[model samples]
Target: MSDLVDKAKNFVAEKIANIKKPEATVTDVDFKNLSRDSVTFNAKVSVSNPYSTSIPICEISYTLKSATRMIASGTIPDPGSLPGNVTTVLDVPVKTPYTILVSLARDIGADWDIDYELDLGFTFDLPIIGDITLPLSTKGEIKLPTISDFF
Candidate 1:
């Protein structure tokens, strides 16, 4: 009886391992806007769903870190849905206060840009598999917007 149960478990595990899941990638991160109190950066994420039906996104959680400091972290609830059988690009806006940016002046002094690591989680429900979170991360430099850009 023990041998049969072990064989059944192995078979189930193998099937689960072979299941196809949605693929996601962080395409780009760029400066989006500059407000009076904060700066906004947009992280572009591309998610390709393998299923034929659109999957509703439960939440999009993000963390922006630079110079070992967590600049911003938040969750966007019920943003939208991922299109089926295609790659969908979603923009996650990360807002950081001017005070935090001021603290990292040394890193910005070299090139007037922020070297950041952005972590994003794309949460969606899959058929028969429950909720699956596709994690995507990207490291890059975002050139700061100059005062001249506004003018």
Candidate 2:
């Protein structure tokens, strides 16, 4: 009986390790030139699951923090499943020196972290059974040219 329990625990851990977390990034940051009342910036986040089993429904958290304060935070309901990938867009006011943090719980013991780049781009690879890091880099943040003059 004890051996069976240990085996079960190991199995569960292996599965949990296989679950992949979504990669959150700012795909596009468009600064609209208007009255400057409140400029809306659009950002995109992508999530992918590579496990054979379907991921359970859970809440996804996205947070944008600056050096001194948190710029924005939001949550979205995700019924994530295996071999599943999704992209979500968010609109936020303009703020400088911001970092985005995206996280989600895969299961009771499994969770995910968003990989980011210095240029405001990122990619996430799902965990698999044998290979810890999957070769797939399905999601990527596209860069847009910076506009010097916005009149």
Candidate 3:
């Protein structure tokens, strides 16, 4: 009887270890809007769902960093669902106040751009597997608009 129980436990563990999970990637991060007080950027996330049916997105959490300093961090609650057997693109808005940007002037002044790392967490509900969080990160430089371009 003990031998049978051990075999059952091993089988279950192996099955769980080989389970197929979702995959995600951060495609791009670009400036979206600029206001007097704040600047907004959009992070594009593409997620592939393998399940047969749509899965509910629990939440999306993100942090934007520049020069090793955190510029902005926030969470989007219940963003939406991922279509089954296909990839879905989601936009996450990151807003930074002018004050914060002003503090990072040195980095921006060097090349009229900001070097940033965007970290994103995508959480989804999977049947039987419960909830899973997929982490994606990307680093790049974003050029600031020139004064003439604003016109």
Candidate 4:
């Protein structure tokens, strides 16, 4: 039983480490003259999981911070089960460059490090029969147009 938990945790950690960060390339930036509003475009993040296991639910979180200030944050479901490759679009108003951190948490239970005594919910009839947490994390960047560059 303990072994199973360790295996699950390792699996999740590896998967999270391998999960690719969202790639963003400015496809188009439209700034109207004399207007502060600008339309910034970038590709949505795409995450792929090759594990042949069923997860009750998968949640992905995105946090963006700039100059020690949190600018924006959001979360979306992993769309690997869908038909397409699962792309999420983010249309952010460029105020300044920011650092983006993306993390994934799932109910797979294969990668969770759970203390059997403390975690009552996961102790009974464990699906994977192991104490494991499958949370993973990665990060990327979004370059905001400088004030002078916008003009």
lDDT leader = 1
lDDT of 4 by residue, 59-150 (tens): 33444332344444444453223122343333323221212211111211334311110000101111333323333333333343456875
Task: Return whichever of 1 and 3 wins on lDDT.
Answer: 1
How well is each residue in 1-151 modelled by candidate 1, as lDDT tens digits? 9999999999999998898888888988999988999999998888888888899999999999998899999999999888879899888999999999999999999999999999998898877878989898889999988889989
Identify the runs in model 3 with alpha carbons over 4 angstroms from their true place: none
Better of 2 and 3 by TM-score: 3
Name the lDDT of candidate 2. Answer: 0.37
- Candidate order by decreasing TM-score: 3, 1, 2, 4
List the pairs of residues colliding in candidate 3. none
Per-residue lDDT of model 3, residues 16-87, tens digit only = 889878898888888889988999998888888888899999999999999999999999999989888999
Question: What lDDT score belongs to each candidate, Candidate 1 first?
Answer: 0.91, 0.37, 0.90, 0.33
Candidate rank order under lDDT: 1, 3, 2, 4
Q: How many backbone collisions does model 2 have? A: 0
- Candidate 1: misplaced stretches above 4 Å? none
**What are the TM-scores, per candidate, against the unseen true structure?**
0.93, 0.39, 0.93, 0.30
